[model samples]
Target: MSRYAILLGAFAVAVMVAGGPSFSQEPGQKGPLVVIVNISNPINQLSAEELEKIYLGKRGFWEWGKPIKMVDLVEEDMNENKSARAIFSAMYMDKSLPALKSYWIRAIFSGKGQPPLVFGRREDVVNYVSQNMEAIGYVRMGELGADNVKSIKILMDNKP
Candidate 1:
């Protein structure tokens, strides 16, 4: 191969390594956020509304009676628009970070519910989900490494 070709190949690999794996998104899927669940969980997909309910503490159990354990990423930087938490909040919960925090605060104060467990790193989130049979969480599409967890499709209404 020519030197130019070798250089280009190296660049491509660098980019992929820096950005994580490439994923082909499905229709109605928005952004790079991927919802993941423990491999033992029977759920294979979730509608956007259902995801919202689960994250917002409205849904507590899977249909088969297993208690739903939700996990979330820590807000690393409020100004980072592309952070996993921001994309997830916008896509699933339809709430900004501050708004979501406020919602959780009120929920906790009123004795209604609590937010999902939060972790600082995506690897930790993946590990937690893999270890807990009922756990569910979201991570950047390319960051889910080889783990005992599965990414479920999120069905969204496409109506304009």
Candidate 2:
């Protein structure tokens, strides 16, 4: 199928459609961000609450598993714009930075654990995940490849 078709289909099937130019365009034409994780990871097929806990730092590790490193691509840069936010929000629950920070602070004070590393760019997240098998992060799906990291289903779909 055409890339547009794939994106439209993804949006239709996905539970949440993030903000972006319509995914029905060429690969680069779409502005939606992509979320990713190690293809080998087995702990993430979790409920939205569990995923939120992991991403929000409310929960320190994978369920019944050791602490797994969580990573995020910073939004300060131009590339990690609405697309990134859209993808991040879809993966977890609420999509607010302050909420995330508050959760992180709570985690740190509670001695649960630290928040995932933050990178200045999307490529940085990919590189970090690529180098570490235990790392999990997100990026623009269009920019993804097989060499560095692999894309995981967004818990929900984002399109339209």
Which candidate has the highest lDDT of all? 1
What clash count does candidate 1 reach? 0
Per-candidate TM-scores read 0.75, 0.62
lDDT of 1 by residue, 6-101 (tens): 999999889778863334343433447789998888899988889988999999999989889999976454343455676678667777778888
- Candidate 2 lDDT (Cα, 0 to 1): 0.62
Tell me, what's the RMSD of every candidate? Answer: 10.3, 7.6
Backbone clashes in model 1, listed as residue pairs: none
Ten-residue region with minimum lDDT total, candidate 2: 20-29
Q: lDDT per residue, candidate 2, 10-47, as tens digits?
A: 87767445543222333343455555666666544445
Collision count for each candidate, in order:
0, 3
